[model samples]
Target: KGKAFFVDLTLCTACRGCQVACKQWKDLPAEETRNVGSHQNPQDLSAKTIRLVRFNEVKEDGKLKWLFFPEQCRHCIEPPCKYIGNMYADGAVKQDPVTGAVIMTDKTKGITRLESWEMCPYNVPRRDEESGIWNKCDMCINRISKGMLPACVKSCPTGTMNFGDRDEMLALANARLAEVQKTNPDAYLADPEHVRVIYLCESAPENYHDRLVASAAQRKNLVAAAPKPKTVTRR
Candidate 1:
């Protein structure tokens, strides 16, 4: 019923094409940045920079391997941010019924910025200092409405980004995982069944990125709270 993106992390070259394309299509300005030794730039996602290709270099078997993760919103099956936002301003953050896109709307201008972040387990959303609204990957709803792929998916030169119906994407994700496991037995699919943006990582999911998916610790906290959406007031 919903759409998804199956990202093969092994194939990602960290070219950052998806990053540039997202900025271009969203008309978001660049943040001031300096060389950080690694090819990854800007360090992290911001209000203007929604899609980021995160690079993590780790030593394995005495060899350094770079893991590139083109990170974006997972568009969770049960988005906690949407529930938290609805408490303060209904429709501020909603999951699109048709496409399953977890989008932050203009009504987000009314929500407490810190609460929005606290509610999001993945820590994906960013607040705009000027507009007071939140921003993150929207799955290019504007383009999808016209029957097109998301900007980042379209711009990816490698076959790392694949998008389609949820079932189709799942099938592809599993198939890719099987193939990758032959060479790297530790390969896995990160939260494939729980989110629309599925990542096929070549090693332990954590070796890819800290927030590659909602952490187990965060899940434990959510469970301890009885999954209640706590209201967050401005500090």
Candidate 2:
């Protein structure tokens, strides 16, 4: 079965249990961050930080509404970055045949930094400043391979994060969408078909992030805009 992640944003209270769990499981170091005048810390994804909880304020009926998006790699079915990198090097990026997890390997070091990192639509990959090696979520492949859920999903106390078979996840997302639409007509799933990480958003996806939802037309345009192999050198 294909791997899947279900993120119920409405059920999330922004407690950040998943965020800390990611850091802990990855054994990543802490980043020195100043008050950015927002509840969000560090402000963005980095090589050492694979996951982050994004906080946004929106005005709904003249009242302030806070929206939280626990952001990470979507692990697309046909990952553009993996495709672009493989055009240049054999093993720069890998897709797990079992779980459909996208992994950036040490072999990525051989690929030109600009081409490999810039190819991602979600801007998920980060290159280490000193080593110039790229890094992103691997869907906790090591753990999943052992029959365990990803750390973030395991750590979420509010049941905001879930992992399972692809079909099951999609069904769950739709059910949650129906429930949310009772009060939130704008509730929808962001990029449900194209991505493994399904997000149940309560408002316009743009209010959370520009890349949160890639409409069918937008995706088609992106595929069209991608440079052909003959026109561009991979490395």
Candidate 3:
């Protein structure tokens, strides 16, 4: 039974503590970023920035609502990145049987970037050009293996990010969703069954962030665009 994460958007403050903790724990360096006229700094995920707290200001029912989404990899139950990666490099991308963490290995250098990324629905994967390896949140496997919560989860000041067993988290997500629905009618759990990271959104999913969940149309387009493997014949 792999572990899972339940993130409560209703409780998130967008303090970016989880974001900063991810960098600190991973020893990832900061990128030079300019103020982009929004609280969402750095603006996007990259080789260095694995987790980002997205801020969206939207008007709902004549009232402006501040939506904060602490975004990271969903770590799909049957990870497409790993499925496709195995074709090119067996160990390039893999899902942990014990923790449900999706890890990108150095051998990812052997897989084509476009193929690997196209397979992902949430578009979470980022590549390091010089190193030629895809990277994303490994669910803080280093700490979790030692029986600790993920760095981001530990760093959250508010009771937003949560980690635990898949069943327990799913139950918690549903229960929280029900409670949130009592107040905000738009609450829903984003892809709870298919992903290890479950996000309980208190508003419309679109208002929280684009790419919040994978869609069938996008998946089809990606499958259509994938490059055909080149075959070599032994003489």
Candidate 4:
């Protein structure tokens, strides 16, 4: 019953089909973006943008390598953001026991502005300007539960975005890593064991984001500092 998603950065062509698909299915509006020098558009994820294709160019072994990471919520088994948000508003955020999908309910409107929205490690949650309701990727739970792939996965023509059971995804990630290592020995899986969404990167995860693969100590701190269930229970 364990749910998971795999992102093979090595196979990603940076086509951004997944990004556009997310917006299309979620009905999210586009943001006005400027020429940011990079082909990456919209600059960053906002309340309206849940998924983004991150591009990074780095020098490796006297050659320039372009890395692409289609980033979104990791849907941690023990979600810190859910703990933090529920402290201010009960039932505002819930994690699906079966799929481990972290969902923000409309009740998120009751959460304090600062407490609920700013505590996520990946900055996944976004608040509606008027309603103050928080939102983020739900792992496309409705589709997943119905035996269908997520829209992003469906639209990915490059075979980069994959979804399956946790064990199957891990096996696919390892097999792909072996193939990628034939040319790039530094390739590895980022936080494979800890997160539901696993990413395979050819270079160090830092080349994508500082928090891409958090250190054990940092993860421990996050878990320890997470709000307690009792603190969030309401009358």
Candidate 5:
């Protein structure tokens, strides 16, 4: 009964409506930015911006292609950030049992290391330098609990952002992937089995973003670096 998101990158026009909607719904303050020759503003996600639309310009077949990636937390079935953060302070990060949404809580302020962020393959979490708290997309849990769609999904003009029950989203993602593969042979769903936020990429996941999908080697390293839980002793 968990919830999920299906992001069809092929359909994304990079209007940034989802990005704005996230900020509005979260009541997050805007970051001051400057023109950096690229359309991608704010440079990267931060405590003020949990979600970001990453613009990447790459050359493919001697032709320039602009890839728009609306990046956010993948809300993994087993979140590494939650595990890593809990190693320092229990409940620093929590996953919603019903929706499987990964959320960073106030307890994160107590964490001393950057292990939580390091453990995340997607590079989603952003830390507040002043408060030492981490932040990221929370799947709009409050709005969804009220029988409403996530702000980003609700405001998306393109068919890029989608949300619903995990099974339903998986079906939708696969169906779209099949349709897209006819045109773009490289089209595939990014980490669909392990992540709740499934992305239908038109090309290789790396063509859109470096950390768009964790590679096999990256996964192996993450597993090797994971800290084992400390055993409790009965007094």
Candidate 6:
């Protein structure tokens, strides 16, 4: 049985404990950053920063509301990035059978960087300038294979992050959605059927991120506008 994550967006306080834990667990280098006018630092996801808590300030009913989105790879049930990567180099991107985790492998260095981003609806993949390899969240596969929760889930102080078998997580997500809906009727799950990582949203999914819910139009535009992949001369 594959594993899954149910993220209750309403419960996320933007404390970023999960973000710090991810870097600590992965031994990823710190990014040198200055205050960018918001609590969210480093701005966006990168090779070293796979998990990011995105912040957005919006006005709702004449009141200011801050939307915090702890974003990462959705690990699609059928990852299109895998197909796009295989088009250039086999095994560059793969979906792990056991955990349903989407992983960008070392073989990614043999593939074009643009195609990986072009096909990923969530825009999750990032290329390492030094290694020439693309990377993203792998669901902390090493820990989970040993029957442990992913580092982010384990570190979250709030009950925002939950992980378990796919079915169990799905049930939890739906249950949470129902409870949240009692207060916020607009609350719903974000593309639960298509992704292993499900998000329970308090409002429209787009309020968190435009790509929070993958759409056919977004995919079509991305593919149509994507520049031709530079030919890779495999060493």
Superposed on all Cα atoms, the candidates' RMSDs to the truth, in angstroms, are: 2.4, 2.4, 3.3, 3.5, 3.9, 2.9
Error of 5 at 226 (Å): 3.9
* lDDT of candidates 1 onward, in order: 0.83, 0.84, 0.85, 0.81, 0.86, 0.86
Query: How far off is residue 125 in model 2, in Å?
Result: 1.0
Q: Residue by residue across 58-137, what tens digits does model 6's lDDT show? A: 88889999999999999888777777766666888887888998888999886664634587889888889899888889
Higher-TM-score candidate of 2 and 3: 3
TM-score of 1: 0.92
Top candidate (TM-score) = 5
Candidate 1 per-residue C-alpha lDDT over 80-183 given as tens digits, one digit per residue, 9 for 90 to 100: 77776666577899888899998999998876645444667788888888998989899999998789999999999999999999999999999888998898
lDDT against true structure, model 5 = 0.86
Q: Candidate 3 vs candidate 4: which has greater lDDT?
A: 3
lDDT: which is higher, 1 or 3? 3
**Of 2 and 6, which scores higher on lDDT?**
6
Instruction: Compose the digit string of candidate 3's lDDT tens values, residues 88-165.
Output: 687888878899899999988877636335768888888887888878999999899999999999999899999999
Q: Which ten residues in a row have the lowest lDDT in candidate 5?
A: 226-235
Which pairs in model 1 have colliding backbones?
none
Predicted candidate 4: what Cα RMSD to the true structure? 3.5
lDDT of 4 by residue, 103-206 (tens): 88898886653543245766667787877887788898888999999999999998889999998999999999999999888888987877888999878877
RMSD of 6: 2.9
Model 1 residue runs over 4 Å out of place are: 113-117, 215-234
Clashes in model 2: which pairs?
none
